[model samples]
Target: MNRIAAPELDIRASADEAAPPLERPMRITILQGAFLPVPALMGGAVEKVWHEMGRQFAAAGHTVTHVSRSHPSLPAEEVVDGVRYLRVPGSDTPRSLAWLKVLDLFYTLRARKALPAADILVTNTFWAPLLLAGARHLGALVVSVQRMPKGQMRWYRKAACWHTVSSAVRDAILAEVPGTEEKIRVIPNPLPESQGSGDDGRLGAKEKVLLYAGRLHPEKGIELFLDALRVEAVRSVLVREGWRIEIVGPWSAAEGGGGESWMDRLRKHAEGLSVTFTGPVHDPALLRDYYQRAAIFVYPSLARTGETFGVAPLEAMAQGAVPVVSDLECFRDFIRDGVNGRIVRVEGESGVADLAEVLQKLMVDADERTRLAQAALAVRTSHAPERVAAMFLKDFALLSTLAVKVSH
Candidate 1:
């Protein structure tokens, strides 16, 4: 893989008085698997991260183009903020992971042409390296992002760099490709700053509402959340007062969810309970308001799909909700047991019991909830977009140098 210097952008307020010449604004492109709508439409963690990254890159005076699958409502070509989105025709969702892979593979071949010629290509698609030959022609340094644990590793052999959201994800990749340790870097997802408009939703309030936001998939532990909410200890408090459980997310056949079967089952299972299912709140202002209104946010994800950094809980924390999440390996990045957020075990009969007890305790204890909410707000500062963006920009500046060294 011969290297070429990425063309510079005119980002200078004046030339590099602080930054090196090579550190000048560079064209960056971010790619995701087919039809994962950008956040403006309805997307998951990967899309959210890609949209935020592109905005950050563009804000820092770089040209950014996001290449993603098109939606019926969104225009084929549109520029939002400073980032230009180039949405190509692709499917809405697939029946299973195997099928999703086939769709991703086909989309990769087509992406080569849709992808912009740029200095760096940061992607979450499993088959990005399949386009390495095409990427090389654009002089783009391909950085493979480990979005999940089970992606195909052979394709990564062609990537110039690998970005991991957590050490667990990095380990998962290294276990498959041991020789690439030198190329890997752990970068936590950058959280956008609070819009500063909603209520803090801190604990110790008169009324408490529990909230869960994100995908309604089985693995995400929505079932467990509903079950725990039914527990005698949890149920008694909610029914006694007028407290409610609000579950908000997007679930559709088009979004890879099996239409209404899973949701119908969940609702039927929670019959007689006061649980409201608000399907996929896409408006940022409205979503932020939900988080701000939440007294406690719970995410009991139990899937073994290499659960990497869970973003919903982080967002909840930023919005001043006392987050209660399952004890997953990746969550240790921010969650400190009883310190910042509550950590519950939901694996077995005993684990479920623990989760029920944790929720019960948080519901009853006001001062403790307030204490946790205070620490939880640190998520906004620690993972601020400016800080995370600076880290990636620093590395992008050195990619040319790294490319030269690796080409040997």
Candidate 2:
């Protein structure tokens, strides 16, 4: 087999005394899933993240290419925000997980030929790491594990590095496939830079909206949110104070949501309450507006296995909405109980009371809510796009150096 050609590392110091050293830029390729589009016009967390990161990478003088499913409004191949976007024939999400994986396999095969010559290939796809493990054209395979691993990590041992969005996901990978600790790297997802708006960060000035932004699936605990609303204390606050819950996200299965049947159940459960379903808002500005206007952001996810890093909660917190999340270990990386946000313990079925209590306190106590929201702003700088991108770049540089040494 031919040896991969790694990018040269440039660690030359800057001319200015205050400026940082100039680093080398590599050709970076990011392969997304077959279901979502690149520009994130249809709304997928991974898509939006990589799209933004691709732009950031390109802005820093790196050649970034993002390949994902094609959309009607977007060109099949075009350069946007300095990043080259290449789209291929793709399909809507299937109802069955097995079928989705099968589709992913076919998509991966198609996406392989579309990949340009690159020094580093970053992907969260099911088959990219397996298919391109020994590809001579691509230099380090960075497998981004955004979700929990289910026996898949065993096959991905050959990857140069495994990027886990949270420590919980890294732990899951080790539990399923041990002895890969040296290959794993924990990096939290970054907040979108476009989320910056001139909106007031004051909690008292925000709307009386209690927001829940994510896919309308059972795993996200939408029903549990409604159940919490049904609690007499929460209901009294809503009725007396006129606080409304706005559920935003795709509800159809095609957009990676619980199908209509699940939505029907949610509607039935949410009866006689001040709830509004805004459907799926794909625009970043509009989504940020929802986060901006809301006083509290509630994400009661029960997907212990499926939930990795809570991007929605992070985005909400960025907009100064005090996040109320379930006690999932993935959330612990950013959310601290009663500090930046509230973590309600979800034990089987008993956690609803705890959820209700937290909501009631936030709704009633303005001082406490403002304090948490102010603290949450710390994520803006901590998980900023530049900071996260720098972490990836450092890892890429290390991997490239290692590859060059091995090749020699």
Q: How does each model score on lDDT?
A: 0.74, 0.84
lDDT of 1 by residue, 189-251 (tens): 867543332234443442488999988778878878888888898899888867888999876
Query: Candidate 1 — which pairs collide?
Result: 249-280
TM-scores for all candidates? 0.88, 0.93
Deviation (Å) of 229 in candidate 2: 1.1
Candidate 1 CA-lDDT value: 0.74
Q: Number of clashing residue pairs in every model?
A: 1, 0
Summed over model 1, clashes come to 1
TM-score: model 2 vs. ground truth: 0.93
